[model samples]
Target: MTTHHRTRWLALPAALLLALLPASASAYPNPGRVTGDITVHDPTMLRAADGTYLLYSTHGGLEARTSTDRIAFSRSGNAFNSPPSWWKTYSSGNDPWAPDISYRGGKYLMYYAVSSFGSSTSAIGFATSSSGKAGTWTDYGIVHSTTGSSNYNAIDPNLFVDDDGKWWLSFGSWWSGLKMIRLDPATGKSYAGDKTVYGIASRPTGTKAVEGPSVVKRNGYYYLFASYDTCCAGTSSTYKIKVGRATSPTGPYYDKNGVAMMNNGGSPVLESHGRYIGPGGQSIMSDTDGDLLVYHYYDGQAGGTAKLGVNLLSWSGGWPTAY
Candidate 1:
């Protein structure tokens, strides 16, 4: 494994070492150290075949950043030189948010959402790039969307390709929480035969703030990691990363304590600690050493600036614990 991909526990202080003990509501660890051009929101990162880390996030035409060591990042420009014309329909400012990037079938596919704040008339857009870098993306148009009449808002999309060769896209925000749909891998769009909109997780009783679903399979279990509560309010943001697990990707997921995720059940993976406030908008990335819990947090020390946060995850006791 590369030096950047190794477990970094040895460098952490005693207080931060408490993160490895168990999942606790109030004992979350501070974000691991990162520097240079780290200001981001709803960030997603993937290491390219050439071992360069490409990080993408909300706004600025889905802003791009690059890192060779995964510790020091440099601004690399936007994924698109010009926003797609269709973006204006959902977001008047043509702002795209929460980009999910993955490498599949010899190409890089990006799934992103375009919508104004708190609007249900949202659309999830698709694009492809051979290089997974700025200026190479070709917008493929909408894969899924919603209107004010719909019960769920379509945004914060994540594409998960199951081990059995099934492609699934999980997305949604506010309105009615997270939803999933089957995708056609051939065209990178919704699958025609399966018109099912799977309900994965939600808060039925209070605060329907769950969004940003990142699904990955480990040890024969499908784990769903999502952001819970409010996001984007700077220091006052209540966002925190939570998780659940199920036997299937389209799941009736349960938290660590056997609470159903569809009814607001989620085990806390990371939350506010010290200078890190509202740590959420997360994506899980697999590295050589282990799975990484990659997300953005409002930096209280920096006057509530959104900054990139990265931490290694340990799946001990069948639940993810971030340190």
Candidate 2:
């Protein structure tokens, strides 16, 4: 929630930020238009099993794109298309950043990012695809790593299975802001103990361009959601989209003015308009005609490139509003 209006330099070229974002974010649609031609970053969603609706993103690598109507997408490739072979040993060939998908043993896993970004040596890899089909990945290697320490650079990863089923995995950035533990539910790969439990810290200048962390749980509470500033750097990006809330599942959360995004403070659920530069890497899915807000923004309509938006969120009085 800090915008005194100063960051600008957008020369508008990537096809005009893709024709002023589907002709100005497609004004009013009962809430349902997000189309422009797939650019995705940090953004992630999955429903498959023939229902179709798979979007996943990340920068410098990872990428996966698709859409059933969340607004026209297509590029379903490079879920690390072909980078292993010891990937330049520590970071040059398989930088494959951000990739998160779920659906256990019956297979679909995903959860990627091998990293070198701000280096802690980085790693959080895993891949499987029982015909979830996106060129059929199958790595399943470093299911979680950390070589030295940026305190926790390991890379933005997210996974879930709560409500008592356990299986957790949130990640961190900026030395330590978001962190979680307990994982292992049937080999989601390691950790059921070194106990980090959960922690949040949205940047009180400890210098965390925040970092994408996503979670969900509606009515019973537990929201999380992070993206705070500076991502992908396409239009001098200074990202946005922040949130908090917690009824447990590791958090002191809070936010809609009750403050406490670990106290660094946060509130606005989404920001940036007119050109949508640096929106965020968020996630949300609910259905039955409810919440949507899947993310990735920065298209003054594709000239600033980096597409995919999909709003249609609501909760109004309890927060989480998007349109």
Candidate 3:
């Protein structure tokens, strides 16, 4: 959906709001308080076994930050002390974006993207580390890629492993919407046999504005969350988080009203309200308290600078509602 479309949705009556969101979006809560080195874009947060929060965001070689109590974060170092030499083959700047980190097989795996702005000549790369801290990444090279000839742009990667031990990587942007491919667990790359790129979600008619997919399984359902509309416009950005659910990981996912995600179907998880504008690029982390919605939003009070916003999710009604 476009910013104009979202603006109209915001103007709808309360009853109409129910058609687009799980609840009346006018009452969406402000983000939980955070301080110190909060500025970020496309933030992906992971808490290590030692109780430290390692947060990564876009650009500057995937800038890294850390926090102990989750309230006060401090700037750390970039994941790469030097950009991988192979990066220049795909990205002109050699700067990476949207790094997704996960722990599996007693190792830390990070999947990131190398691309320039508004371009489809992009590549998705992978790295592994014994520890997920800064300067420890060992580049495994490109996992998937796309050229200007391709319909999809390969970026914003999210890895979802199912209960049956299947690995899937979902990544895409503007041109043809979200795409997923089965991954080999051992190599952390695309599976050779089933190389089909699954089309998960898109806006066919209006703005093709969905990206940043994060999938998590809860109570027998696999939820696919994505950012909608414009990002990086600071306070003017219309970015918000939307979600759909399916029984399988590579899904014909559906929203609350049974609309298919592939047909532009999504129920609002978070959106612009008050000082919090354009809350998106979200990742779900199951914390000690509950499922934390970790994302970045343009802070209206801070000259529209991007900042981290964390909110606990309530899944009481079988759909995620942020409190």
Candidate 4:
């Protein structure tokens, strides 16, 4: 969430054929099942009301695309608001990144981040669409803000409705790491102070930089997936997908080796496959088939850049393994 999370060396993504590998092949699914190339990054996808997987990925600013097959895609449109007045528009500034699109109360709710690097002054704003398409989206200014001096650099945001139907928002930076708070479902505001941090992905104890927290559940296990080290620095980022699992939503998550996730004990679910660098900043979706972990990887298929990758996810032995 914070702008302080810098980039590391790029990792070439693994081979695309790993998608066809049998699910029982390995414990960790690094190269996902869904395959293709388009340079998708910080991806957020949903099975929309119209039966389309509407993928809103971070394209400098937020852009909309849709795919029914999950492999083929078509661009839909750009950010709903055309850049709000409060957010600086200098040099195509204050991009809308890492979006969370959901349908509640028969209306679509979109939570998007507006910020630029080297500045802690960031904000997570809200938008809405009646049809979840190109037209009719209204922006609500600044759901949360970072003064460019805050320790917890607010950026990547995730919205979830728990088992009890309680809504909450999880966000923060790699500097101070990831955090969560109860949300006012009616207002989309934090019910408690953002200070009450729940999950913190601090920089490997001695080192720094850890952000992009995504939380989901599978087969009664709550899996906390996050990208640590660096992302988007081309070949300099040391991006990897690490996860901690728990029995409950608010963890106390443990790795496959029985180590605690809160204690920085996450087994690797996604790491670089040579040139597939920074394969993190992930999201998940479910359909008639199953759950899918959607994220980005530095793809060399198009001369090397951070492109989006989707892999089918399966839970085995209480751990999340990609296909």
Candidate 5:
């Protein structure tokens, strides 16, 4: 969640900016107008029924922020004033990571990961809030996890509910790539009947850096989006967002070219170009304007500082294009 490295870089020259820009001109879309406490990582956002925009991201006790018109954001304390005591069972520091939040069953549900850096001994924990406010969440303990003996690292939890009312949780990082398991709609835990952990995406041969899985259903197809390559290196980071699709939530997802995602097939949704060095760790949210692609990018113009980057997504071609 929180990276240790500090990035420092000079701004791009005007001449080089034109050359580095995407060829189509429209290919390079600027992040939506936002200001005030925009520093964040792995951000997931939702508009409350009262029209308040709540944004939660990775940090100490899962940092929180709020927006009134979706443009300007301000710090609103953290989800927890102190780390949950049970967190020590999984994370050595008792600090949690990427938090996936959604309004489900008329209440706010958040699933997050707790683990040490580069360690497979990780766990995905759950929490709920009646009012989705800071210091109001109740920890529900671990939903799922993997020990050092397991091949897959359990982190970056994402909850997806299908139209038929089936709940699926997709999560993973490194080791064996992205994974999803069926969950009980009521408890938000693994479904009792189906004990299947489906493999959706992987980079088997080279760097197994693909992670941060988020699933969104658009036009009858379930699209799987994930972050690929090295992250947390600031401007030196190579993280980029990629996508694949399938009819079923538990997928043998394929890219635009019909290549299976399990074999490293993914179409680039967003990448480092121009001044947006390493744009990734993305989550999709349906806003009043349209679908918003929210993520953290190392700002090349600001010494590679991690900043919030949000762009509206256009899916006219049956594939997502960020603008």
Candidate 6:
């Protein structure tokens, strides 16, 4: 096993130290208090080895923010000094969205998507950094992409490294739901041996508004968390986070009710409530305290501005409950 894998397993005990007492299921808890530079979209965060929190989000060449205590964040800079030239091929304006960051193989890797609004022609790009800081990333080009004629869209990339050292990337939007591809750990690119695109979740019958997938393993089950319904509409957005689980990383995921995720089945994790409107675009982080549900929500009190939302999760009954 690799040293990285060994370190991760040793840290699992602390990462799985969730709250024993579950929160009321009906009451969606408000986000934990945060201040300064909280406005963000599709935020992906990870605590560096030095204990500084690094956050990267959509736009502004993948805008960045840093926090010493995970509360008062300050805008650091963009991940890239300038948008890569290849980005213009998918997005005329060089817009990228929904970045997923991780520490693997002794390096910080980031996967982000580039595409124009309502377009299936999108590309997921990869980059690497030694320090997990803005302006230090070196773009490695596209990892996966889709054309207008493809059945699925390739945006919102999330990398999931299994317990046995296998890497899987889950991403998609609007066309045919979420999909996953095996990754070669050496290259951080798609595995040449396995070209099969696995469909993990979808909404086949109703609105195909499911996207932004984040996968994590806990208690012998692989949980798939995704956003559902329309997003980016501010106060009118119906975006919410939902979840399903399977025994394998490449899954036939089922919701709490045993309904298949491909058939519009997902148990709600977080939804629009009170001043927190359209809560979605979530990523799960294993922090010192516990598992955290980190995402963005439109602030009703702030004129529909997108802001960062953080809440600890409890795995009281084998399923995660965001509190």
Model 5 steric clash pairs: none
Please give, for residues 206-290, the per-residue lDDT of candidate 2 as tens digits: 5666776777877888888888867777777878878878888677788877888876777777776667777787767665467
The segments of candidate 3 whose C-alpha lies over 4 angstroms from its true place after superposition are 1-25
Of the candidates numbered 1 and 6, which has the greater TM-score value?
1
TM-score of each: 0.93, 0.31, 0.91, 0.83, 0.92, 0.92
Candidate 5, residue 164: the lDDT equals 94
Q: What are the per-residue Cα lDDT tens digits for candidate 4 across 1-323?
A: 01121111113234544555565554444454344335677888888876887878775457778777676777777656466786673224656778887888888888877777755677787878787876457887777777756777667888878888777677776556676767777777766544354664454475456667788866777777888777787766688888887776667777778777555577898887655666888887776666777888876555657777777676867777776
Q: For model 3, state the Cα shift of residue 48 in Å.
A: 1.0
TM-score quality measure for candidate 5: 0.92
For residues 185-248, write the lDDT of model 3, one tens digit per residue: 9799999989999999988979999999999999899999999999999989999999999998
Clashes of each: 0, 9, 0, 29, 0, 0
User: For each candidate, what is the lDDT?
Assistant: 0.92, 0.70, 0.89, 0.70, 0.90, 0.92
Candidate no. 1 TM-score: 0.93
Candidate with the larger lDDT of 1 and 3? 1
Better of 1 and 4 by lDDT: 1
Task: Give the residue spans of candidate 2 off by over 4 A.
Answer: 1-63, 66-69, 72-75, 84-95, 99-112, 115-120, 123-146, 157-175, 178-292, 295-309, 313-320
Error (Å) of candidate 2 at residue 216 is: 21
lDDT of 5: 0.90
| Candidate 6 deviation (Cα RMSD) | 6.9
Residues 1-323 of candidate 5 have per-residue lDDT tens digits of 10111111125566876887666774656676678999998999999999999999998799999988787899998998888887897877778889999998789999999988899999999999998888889988889989999999899999999999999999999999999999998788989999999999999988999999999999999999999999999999999999999999999899999989999899999998777889888999998777989999998989999999988898999999987
- Model 6 lDDT tens row, 1-323: 12343365456666353343245434787888789999999999999999999999999999999998888999999999999999999999898899999998799999999999999999999999999899999999999999999999999999999999999999999888999999999999999999999999988887999999999999999999999998999889899999999999999999999999999999999999888999999999999878899999999999999999998898899899987
- Candidate 1 lDDT (Cα, 0 to 1): 0.92
Q: After aligning candidate 6 to the native by TM-score, how far in Å is the CA of 130 from where it should be?
A: 0.7
Q: Arrange candidates, best lDDT first.
A: 6, 1, 5, 3, 4, 2
In model 4, state the lDDT of residue 248: 67
- CA displacement after TM-score superposition, residue 23 of candidate 3 (Å): 16
